[model samples]
Target: MNRLSRVSIAAFALAAGAALTGCVVAPVGPYYGEPVVTAPPPPQVEAVPVAPYPGWLWIGGYWTWQANRHVWVGGHWAAPRPGWRYVPHRWDPGPRGWREAPGRWERR
Candidate 1:
Protein backbone atom coordinates (compact mmCIF):
# COMPACT_ATOMS: atom_id res chain seq x y z
CA MET A 1 0.00 0.00 0.00
CA ASN A 2 1.11 3.60 -0.61
CA ARG A 3 2.24 5.71 2.40
CA LEU A 4 -1.01 7.73 2.41
CA SER A 5 -3.15 4.60 2.21
CA ARG A 6 -1.27 3.02 5.12
CA VAL A 7 -1.79 6.14 7.28
CA SER A 8 -5.49 6.22 6.45
CA ILE A 9 -5.91 2.56 7.30
CA ALA A 10 -4.11 3.06 10.61
CA ALA A 11 -6.31 5.99 11.53
CA PHE A 12 -9.46 4.10 10.62
CA ALA A 13 -8.39 1.09 12.68
CA LEU A 14 -7.68 3.29 15.70
CA ALA A 15 -11.04 5.00 15.47
CA ALA A 16 -12.88 1.70 15.11
CA GLY A 17 -11.11 0.24 18.11
CA ALA A 18 -11.99 3.26 20.22
CA ALA A 19 -15.64 3.14 19.21
CA LEU A 20 -15.99 -0.58 19.86
CA THR A 21 -14.43 -0.33 23.31
CA GLY A 22 -16.22 2.89 24.26
CA CYS A 23 -18.63 1.14 26.64
CA VAL A 24 -15.77 -0.09 28.82
CA VAL A 25 -14.56 3.42 29.44
CA ALA A 26 -15.34 4.68 32.96
CA PRO A 27 -17.26 7.91 33.50
CA VAL A 28 -15.04 10.92 34.16
CA GLY A 29 -16.97 12.24 37.17
CA PRO A 30 -19.31 11.24 40.01
CA TYR A 31 -22.18 10.33 37.71
CA TYR A 32 -23.15 9.92 34.06
CA GLY A 33 -25.06 13.26 34.34
CA GLU A 34 -27.89 12.24 31.98
CA PRO A 35 -31.08 13.12 33.85
CA VAL A 36 -34.82 12.62 33.47
CA VAL A 37 -37.57 14.89 34.63
CA THR A 38 -38.57 12.35 37.28
CA ALA A 39 -38.03 8.72 38.28
CA PRO A 40 -40.02 6.36 40.46
CA PRO A 41 -38.68 5.40 43.84
CA PRO A 42 -36.88 2.09 44.20
CA PRO A 43 -39.11 -0.91 44.83
CA GLN A 44 -39.42 -2.62 48.17
CA VAL A 45 -36.74 -5.27 48.42
CA GLU A 46 -37.20 -8.69 49.99
CA ALA A 47 -35.32 -9.74 53.09
CA VAL A 48 -31.76 -10.68 52.32
CA PRO A 49 -30.97 -14.36 52.66
CA VAL A 50 -28.09 -15.64 54.70
CA ALA A 51 -24.71 -15.13 53.10
CA PRO A 52 -23.59 -18.12 51.08
CA TYR A 53 -20.18 -17.80 52.65
CA PRO A 54 -18.31 -15.63 55.04
CA GLY A 55 -17.06 -12.23 53.87
CA TRP A 56 -19.91 -11.76 51.41
CA LEU A 57 -21.71 -8.44 51.28
CA TRP A 58 -25.34 -7.81 50.36
CA ILE A 59 -25.69 -5.25 47.62
CA GLY A 60 -29.13 -3.65 47.70
CA GLY A 61 -31.49 -3.16 44.80
CA TYR A 62 -31.87 0.16 43.01
CA TRP A 63 -33.97 1.81 40.32
CA THR A 64 -32.61 2.21 36.80
CA TRP A 65 -34.12 4.21 33.98
CA GLN A 66 -35.15 2.07 31.02
CA ALA A 67 -37.51 2.54 28.12
CA ASN A 68 -38.08 6.08 29.40
CA ARG A 69 -39.26 4.68 32.75
CA HIS A 70 -37.83 3.42 35.99
CA VAL A 71 -37.02 -0.27 36.37
CA TRP A 72 -36.18 -2.21 39.51
CA VAL A 73 -33.10 -4.38 39.71
CA GLY A 74 -32.95 -6.81 42.62
CA GLY A 75 -30.26 -7.06 45.23
CA HIS A 76 -27.75 -9.88 45.59
CA TRP A 77 -24.75 -11.03 47.52
CA ALA A 78 -21.30 -10.16 46.30
CA ALA A 79 -18.03 -11.57 47.49
CA PRO A 80 -15.94 -9.05 49.29
CA ARG A 81 -12.74 -8.06 47.54
CA PRO A 82 -9.52 -7.34 49.25
CA GLY A 83 -8.84 -3.64 49.88
CA TRP A 84 -12.07 -2.63 48.19
CA ARG A 85 -15.63 -1.70 49.11
CA TYR A 86 -18.70 -1.83 46.91
CA VAL A 87 -20.55 1.43 46.35
CA PRO A 88 -24.20 0.95 45.46
CA HIS A 89 -25.79 2.76 42.54
CA ARG A 90 -28.21 5.58 43.30
CA TRP A 91 -30.48 8.12 41.62
CA ASP A 92 -30.49 11.77 42.56
CA PRO A 93 -32.68 14.56 41.25
CA GLY A 94 -30.95 17.07 39.01
CA PRO A 95 -32.08 20.26 37.36
CA ARG A 96 -32.69 18.48 34.09
CA GLY A 97 -33.69 15.06 35.49
CA TRP A 98 -32.70 12.17 37.69
CA ARG A 99 -28.96 11.50 37.47
CA GLU A 100 -27.85 7.90 37.84
CA ALA A 101 -24.67 7.11 39.68
CA PRO A 102 -23.51 3.64 38.82
CA GLY A 103 -22.11 1.33 41.46
CA ARG A 104 -18.40 0.64 41.63
CA TRP A 105 -15.72 -0.73 43.90
CA GLU A 106 -13.42 1.72 45.61
CA ARG A 107 -10.02 1.06 47.09
CA ARG A 108 -10.00 1.13 50.86
Candidate 2:
Protein backbone atom coordinates (compact mmCIF):
# COMPACT_ATOMS: atom_id res chain seq x y z
CA MET A 1 0.00 0.00 0.00
CA ASN A 2 1.14 3.56 -0.71
CA ARG A 3 1.99 5.90 2.21
CA LEU A 4 -1.12 8.01 1.59
CA SER A 5 -3.42 4.98 1.64
CA ARG A 6 -1.72 3.60 4.75
CA VAL A 7 -2.13 6.91 6.54
CA SER A 8 -5.79 7.09 5.61
CA ILE A 9 -6.36 3.55 6.86
CA ALA A 10 -4.66 4.36 10.16
CA ALA A 11 -6.80 7.45 10.64
CA PHE A 12 -9.94 5.48 9.96
CA ALA A 13 -8.92 2.87 12.54
CA LEU A 14 -8.37 5.54 15.19
CA ALA A 15 -11.77 7.13 14.53
CA ALA A 16 -13.46 3.74 14.75
CA GLY A 17 -11.72 2.95 18.03
CA ALA A 18 -12.77 6.24 19.56
CA ALA A 19 -16.39 5.52 18.73
CA LEU A 20 -16.19 2.04 20.18
CA THR A 21 -14.57 3.36 23.35
CA GLY A 22 -17.64 5.50 24.15
CA CYS A 23 -15.51 8.62 24.17
CA VAL A 24 -17.94 10.40 21.85
CA VAL A 25 -21.12 11.68 23.46
CA ALA A 26 -24.46 12.58 21.92
CA PRO A 27 -24.28 16.30 21.05
CA VAL A 28 -21.24 18.13 22.32
CA GLY A 29 -21.19 20.99 24.86
CA PRO A 30 -23.24 21.31 28.08
CA TYR A 31 -26.67 19.70 28.14
CA TYR A 32 -29.46 22.19 27.52
CA GLY A 33 -32.45 20.22 28.79
CA GLU A 34 -34.11 22.56 31.29
CA PRO A 35 -30.96 22.79 33.45
CA VAL A 36 -31.38 20.40 36.39
CA VAL A 37 -29.46 22.50 38.87
CA THR A 38 -29.35 20.93 42.33
CA ALA A 39 -28.16 23.18 45.08
CA PRO A 40 -24.81 22.12 46.46
CA PRO A 41 -24.72 20.99 50.07
CA PRO A 42 -23.22 23.32 52.62
CA PRO A 43 -19.66 22.73 53.76
CA GLN A 44 -19.12 20.55 56.78
CA VAL A 45 -18.38 22.44 59.97
CA GLU A 46 -14.85 21.84 61.18
CA ALA A 47 -14.95 19.69 64.30
CA VAL A 48 -11.48 20.62 65.36
CA PRO A 49 -11.42 24.02 66.97
CA VAL A 50 -8.55 26.36 66.43
CA ALA A 51 -5.81 26.63 69.02
CA PRO A 52 -3.68 29.42 67.61
CA TYR A 53 -3.82 29.09 63.84
CA PRO A 54 -3.83 32.42 62.00
CA GLY A 55 -3.84 31.53 58.29
CA TRP A 56 -6.42 28.75 58.41
CA LEU A 57 -9.29 29.49 56.07
CA TRP A 58 -12.62 27.80 55.38
CA ILE A 59 -12.56 25.73 52.18
CA GLY A 60 -16.32 25.31 52.28
CA GLY A 61 -18.41 22.10 52.19
CA TYR A 62 -19.29 19.69 49.39
CA TRP A 63 -21.88 17.00 48.47
CA THR A 64 -20.70 13.45 48.06
CA TRP A 65 -22.34 10.09 47.25
CA GLN A 66 -21.40 6.49 46.58
CA ALA A 67 -22.62 4.19 43.80
CA ASN A 68 -21.47 1.76 41.14
CA ARG A 69 -21.16 4.38 38.44
CA HIS A 70 -19.49 7.41 40.03
CA VAL A 71 -18.89 9.01 43.41
CA TRP A 72 -19.72 12.59 44.36
CA VAL A 73 -17.06 14.22 46.57
CA GLY A 74 -18.12 17.38 48.34
CA GLY A 75 -15.93 20.40 48.92
CA HIS A 76 -14.13 21.05 52.22
CA TRP A 77 -12.30 23.79 54.10
CA ALA A 78 -8.55 23.39 54.11
CA ALA A 79 -6.40 24.67 56.91
CA PRO A 80 -3.27 26.28 55.59
CA ARG A 81 -0.37 24.32 57.03
CA PRO A 82 1.98 27.30 57.07
CA GLY A 83 2.62 28.95 53.71
CA TRP A 84 -0.06 27.81 51.28
CA ARG A 85 -3.04 30.11 50.59
CA TYR A 86 -6.61 28.84 50.35
CA VAL A 87 -8.26 28.77 46.95
CA PRO A 88 -12.05 28.92 47.03
CA HIS A 89 -14.00 26.06 45.46
CA ARG A 90 -15.77 26.39 42.15
CA TRP A 91 -18.48 24.45 40.30
CA ASP A 92 -18.59 22.70 36.95
CA PRO A 93 -21.61 20.94 35.41
CA GLY A 94 -22.11 17.69 33.53
CA PRO A 95 -24.94 15.50 32.32
CA ARG A 96 -25.11 13.53 35.59
CA GLY A 97 -24.67 16.51 37.96
CA TRP A 98 -22.48 19.40 39.01
CA ARG A 99 -18.89 18.89 40.11
CA GLU A 100 -16.97 20.88 42.70
CA ALA A 101 -13.35 21.36 41.80
CA PRO A 102 -10.74 21.92 44.48
CA GLY A 103 -9.03 25.29 44.84
CA ARG A 104 -5.28 25.87 44.82
CA TRP A 105 -3.02 28.32 46.62
CA GLU A 106 -0.08 30.25 45.27
CA ARG A 107 2.97 31.23 47.23
CA ARG A 108 3.43 34.88 48.12
Q: Give the winner by TM-score.
A: 1
Score candidate 1 by lDDT. 0.81
| TM-score of candidate 2 relative to the true fold | 0.33
Q: What is the lDDT of residue 86 in candidate 1?
A: 90
Residue-level lDDT of model 2, residues 34-96, one tens digit each, is 233564555555455553456556554444332212234544446666665666555567787
Pairs that clash in candidate 1: 36-97, 36-98
The candidate that wins on lDDT is 1
Lowest summed lDDT over 10 consecutive residues: which window, candidate 2? 63-72
Q: Cα miss at 65, model 2 (Å)?
A: 4.7
What are the RMSDs of all candidates, in order?
6.7, 9.7
The TM-score of candidate 1 is: 0.66
Candidate 1 structure quality by residue, lDDT tens digits, 1-108:
899999999999999999898577654533365877777684676799999999899998878777767778889999889999898887778777778887889998
